[model samples]
Target: MRYFLIPALTAFLAAQTIRVGVDLVSVPVLVLSREGRVVPDLQPADFHLFDNDVPQAFVLDTSVSPLSVAIVVQANQDVRAYLPFIAKIGNAVDALLIGEAGEAAAVVYGDEVTVAKPFESGDLSLALRKLAPDGRNARAIDAGMRAIDLLRARASNHRRVLLYIGQPADHGSESPLDELRDAAETYNVTIHAVALPEIGKTFVSDTFSLQGLSSRSDRGGFKAGTDLGRLIPTVARTAAAAQSADPFSVLAAATGGTQLHFREQKQLEDAVAILGIELHSDYVLSFTPKGTGYHTLRVEVDVPGAKTHARPGYRLTTN
Candidate 1:
């Protein structure tokens, strides 16, 4: 029979999750310089947080807990060509993001939401290999909700994360987009995505920029953190590029996560590596929220030439 997070990883998870055990709203913040390096040696006193534009007292939590990731794939017939390349990424994912103590679960969505792999420790790529295209409908929202439901039961000591792999748009889903959006905050799950383009759509590679070191560095004109305000907007956008009602972009932005692009095997593997780096090199901030309903969050880094990215909002309901 299958199991949850392995026993060997339990000790590691606890050691990394040291924090006050109360009603704390934890937010993971990513601070990067224009050179594409994470800002190091930051103190709690060097930052400020605002809820709905009102400054609030908070504490910097230095916890790097093992990740509990839910990998959601859109396995519709339209994406049949992309499955072969995607299936071979299990070992890379197992080595990088799932690392030492992290656990992962896989979900594939088409006409129905299917759990390809339960939360486990070893050989994540096999989960991808099992994905086969089914019906024409792409029930991405429904599958995402199922992923969240799986993670909600996991221990709080693990940082919950969700990764979506599919086209930009959704075809048919029973759950409304708003419901899935709210569930992410309620469960404190960070959302990231590997977005692919729809078939037969001619895409230009000229506009894409990889999220790493600038080629300008070789030209002796490298800038450091020019955009200190590249933050998530409070309201998720209704469109992404040329797609109608892009759910992946909306979900990624709303949850302070990134939406990466991939067209071939190499780009897909590179996206996995970049994701591992971004997840491992973030700062986690925690605060005890006062009231209920919807809460808007804003974070500012005190360091010079440091840009910040964090979840824009969260929701709570007192029982």
Candidate 2:
């Protein structure tokens, strides 16, 4: 009698349909190469997707959908040197979204974190002018995080593209890395970082000069004893780590976005253009999780003989 009752309850529950909550789906793809060169003609099958180290399914659907893009310009002294590159990005995003009637784009600066552009009637040129460069004492990381939070809040059912242009710094952030990661996981925002050119040369050279005599005096007055080689690598490593730890790649990698480094204005402009093209060219897919709770999803294309660029996996909020 007990076995029969258990089987009957199970069957009744199975027969009852459960309506899940909002099933929002977004598929973001990161384009990268081991050598930093763009790989072309890649199909969906060339890629494998994972979620929490588990594999799911992959699907692609090419269609025009509404999109929300946030362009966060990091305008510190280092980025100020690359203003032309910044302007080019503004122009490219303006061009891309203006054609699609309902699409929206917002530009934020370190000084003013959130300002909306009239995607329908307002001119982007004016908004671009309004984005003041960072003040001498302004904080870049704080401004960037604020901008990201605002953008994430505004993105509803549309795909989001966040382009961060500047060096990432977390000097004032109080949140731990895990907390930051959780926020990104919850929001499903992809971060793409554009690291400006290296600007530490002058500072390094000055420091070397100041320390040269001290080291020589200590080393039996031998000039070779002041080996700049050791100092140079150490300085370089420290600077690189500081910059890399900035939330740029952290958000980007987690959300399946690409980070680009530019040495010239043209390269930066080209990268923005490429990003826009990829966002528009790719496909959108949606599926209900097989089980409840958090589910991982993998997306891939089925181009039999071509290579492909797609995200490894995405987290789904299940009902």
Candidate 3:
């Protein structure tokens, strides 16, 4: 018995530290055309990847593997109005997590983020229902950061998608934007933002007024309303500025993901469908850089007589 136990322990230790050859790093490069279509026919030779401005050799691994995704839903008042849009996301959830094994995805709402389904096929509607309750005080940026951190801890050789289901807001986040960006870069997590179109001008105006007045109420509610009326343009300008510098887009772009905006409600389903297909269709490439510091990587595809859209760059880990 002692001899058998000794061999088993040795084998377990060896398995825990097993490293694959240089040919097995699984970094997937998802190539999207300029028109928001995924180009699946591109071969390994068609791509040229660079690390720190130095060329690195890579291989395309097209094998099917489990995917881990984190869906951060903004549950603010603005997001609540788009309940149907949220419902459509439930449909997308069904499409991805139904049959895959070892696949885990969660829904983040307000200050709380919960794992709805863990890569199983049945009963995802419960998770969708969990996302329905709107949190009056949830912050979008904070939720995004939480999702990123969660995915980073659960890193895998398979693909990871950080799907954000609303606009960007930087309220009550303790981590700065730069920190979040660094974490995303380190983990190679691709961000997909679904910007819900403006529900209505009145909705936006009312939401803004309410947010401002909530900060101060000792002087009387009527006075707060008057003050907010005076500052309406400023509020509008602030919101506009916020949208222009969309944190979701910024995170997506920084980590080789695309940001999509849809005005019509039906388009949400289309976007999620596109995402599901892209997850299974991309080519994974791997390479080792020349030095040991942070290195920028650029992936390009040389498809003759065709235009391609790929990530501008990636920060390669060199430790």
Candidate 4:
């Protein structure tokens, strides 16, 4: 099984990660035939895995794998009107995102980062319902870092994931966005997010969309090297191409996850349902590589006219 990562994608993982090394590099992959349906069966030999553009040996996993998901939400006054709906989403998340086999932890940020539900104690609904918007500032990056910290402590058998629900841009995060992104990359964490605007600004999506990420009928539309160009941007913050006006988009794209938009209750619910389907259908490819520094990841499928979405890269350090 694979956990998930990539270079410059907005986020899931090789679709995004892998284990079996000092630091696991897991990449979740979505393979769609020309007909626009998920390609369920494929051997490791049917696909090629590359790190820093060089082909490497890998193990392919295409089954139901449990996840260790960290749910991070914004609890600032800016989105106060939507808090009621956000609070109630615990059921949807349980039924759709994590399910029975997976475990999840929750973190809410307003003036500070608060852990509403820990991994072991899991009544997310009650914890979420108790949330009350506290400060004027939105500390999204800080909240994200906290979520990553929680996920890192989990068992490696579970796929590492982070779900961010908040405003498009950061407001008062003392930590730079790159710091959080680097941490996510270093740990092979796949990030997915839904950007919430202030009250009236709901429903309108940002410049990028996940609508076509996994489904495109045109066989010529997407192929290897087409998606996940660079899963993780250089942690050094040298790559301006990975920069985004909306901070969530940067984290999502670079981590092999998608950044979605929603202002209404239905939009949020629909987003969760869509994410569930996407996550479950992925074919994860994992590898143990040598050396360190930043690694670029690329995925190639042998199936004809198959479009693939994968995490682009991950960072590794030798102890």
List the candidates ranked by lDDT, beginning with the highest. 1, 4, 3, 2
Off by over 4 Å in 2: 1-22, 29-59, 105-122, 136-141, 153-155, 174-178, 201-246, 290-297, 300-307, 315-319
| Candidate 4 global TM-score | 0.80
Per-residue lDDT of candidate 1, residues 1-319 (tens digit): 0112223223322343323223688878867664545565578887888888888888787755678889899888989999998888887666557766678999999998998888844346777887889999999999999999999888777788999988867788989988988899888888988888887775422122223333433321112223312222222333452143778777887788877777887767766665665676567788888789889888887866666778887888785
Question: Comparing 1 and 3 by TM-score, which wins?
Answer: 1
Query: What's every prediction's RMSD, in angstroms?
Result: 6.7, 19.5, 17.6, 7.7
Measured against the true structure, the TM-scores of the candidates, in listed sequence, are 0.82, 0.62, 0.68, 0.80
Note the Cα lDDT for every prediction shown: 0.72, 0.46, 0.51, 0.70
Lowest summed lDDT window (length 10), candidate 1: 219-228
- Superposition error at 84 for model 2 (Å): 4.6
Q: After superposition, how far is residue 252 of candidate 4 from its true place, in Å?
A: 0.9
Clashing pairs in 3: 98-121, 103-119
Top candidate on TM-score is 1
Q: How accurate is candidate 3 locally (lDDT)?
A: 0.51
Error of 3 at 118 (Å): 6.2
Kindly list the per-residue Cα lDDT of model 2 for residues 28-88, writing each as its tens digit.
5423222222223344465555545455454533344455566666654545766655654
Candidate of highest lDDT: 1
How do the residues 101-194 of candidate 3 rate in per-residue lDDT, one tens digit apiece? 3244555555554555544343455565555655565566666677776776664654566887775554555667766777676666777676
